[model samples]
Target: MYQESSFKHDAAPPMEYFLWIIPTGRASDAYGYSQAKTPTWSDYIRETGNNGADRDDFDDAIDFMAWFVYKTHKVNSISKWDAYAQYLNYHEGWGGYKRGTYKKKSG
Candidate 1:
């Protein structure tokens, strides 16, 4: 839905605005942040433990989106969940798209 629209449309608003719509925070008794706690992009990243690193630059945007969706939806796979979380954390503050690993063009 949102992910597809974001990826397919060039005129779409920046990912930051879309990400802001998702909530973030923790309810009492919750062990981790929730959609309710995320009010801003920075807040979401901070609460999710994405501290921003160079490694995240190499990941596809779709991968990030899928991981974000999975986290927001509270999916069940521990490995997938952790992998997404780590990726998010690794690439937090960086912006702009990087070429896919298989792309012929060099950055």
Candidate 2:
């Protein structure tokens, strides 16, 4: 999340991400300190019953990240201590990671 948003509550992706990253116009609806996408954020709210959570709120952001990490581990059997794998999961999403999409990337 820090790498995604630089710890800024209002961090947003650069214009090019919106212009070219996705054919729809943006990489995702990711925003704020956690850079959480709308669908995932909504899931967090639904799963945790944190209906009032805000992306720009530090506490909410941290809690959202923790929940994502927990879910990543639970759904993917990824060790929480595995930062590299966790990071790939974070960026690629649980399903994407499970599908081994990261293996196709050159980086």
Candidate 3:
């Protein structure tokens, strides 16, 4: 939450939601405190049955983040408490992490 949006509820306003795009030419579609992208958010909604979830809503954001981290652990085998690895997975999708895409970044 803090890393994603500094806990700002309106991190990505509804009208200007398309502003946050990934450098890879991918439309991030990320919004709110959780900074969750549309496809992933929809997956969360479908998986958890949280049909009314809103990214800007604190409770919903927290739930979405928790669910994401939980899924990260299940799919990536990264410990939930391992903030570093979890963050990497969070930033890079699970498939990207699995493919070592983070290692390709020229730091």
Q: Using lDDT, give the best candidate's number.
A: 2
Per-candidate TM-score against the hidden true structure:
0.24, 0.86, 0.82
Clashing pairs in 3: none
Q: Which ten residues in a row have the lowest lDDT in candidate 1?
A: 28-37
Best-to-worst lDDT order: 2, 3, 1
Q: Which candidate achieves the best TM-score against the true structure?
A: 2
Identify the superior model by lDDT, candidate 2 or candidate 3: 2
Q: lDDT of each structure?
A: 0.34, 0.88, 0.87
lDDT of model 3, residue 21? 56
lDDT of 1 by residue, 13-36 (tens): 233333767644323211111211
Per-residue lDDT of model 2, residues 1-107, tens digit only: 67989899988765544355544344467989999999999999999999999999999999998998899889999898899998999999998998999999995
Model 2 clashing residue pairs (backbone): none
Off by over 4 Å in 2: 16-25
Task: Score residue 68 of candidate 2 by CA lDDT.
Answer: 87
lDDT of 3 by residue, 8-98 (tens): 9878634433456533343557888899988899999999999999988999999998999999999999999999999999899899999
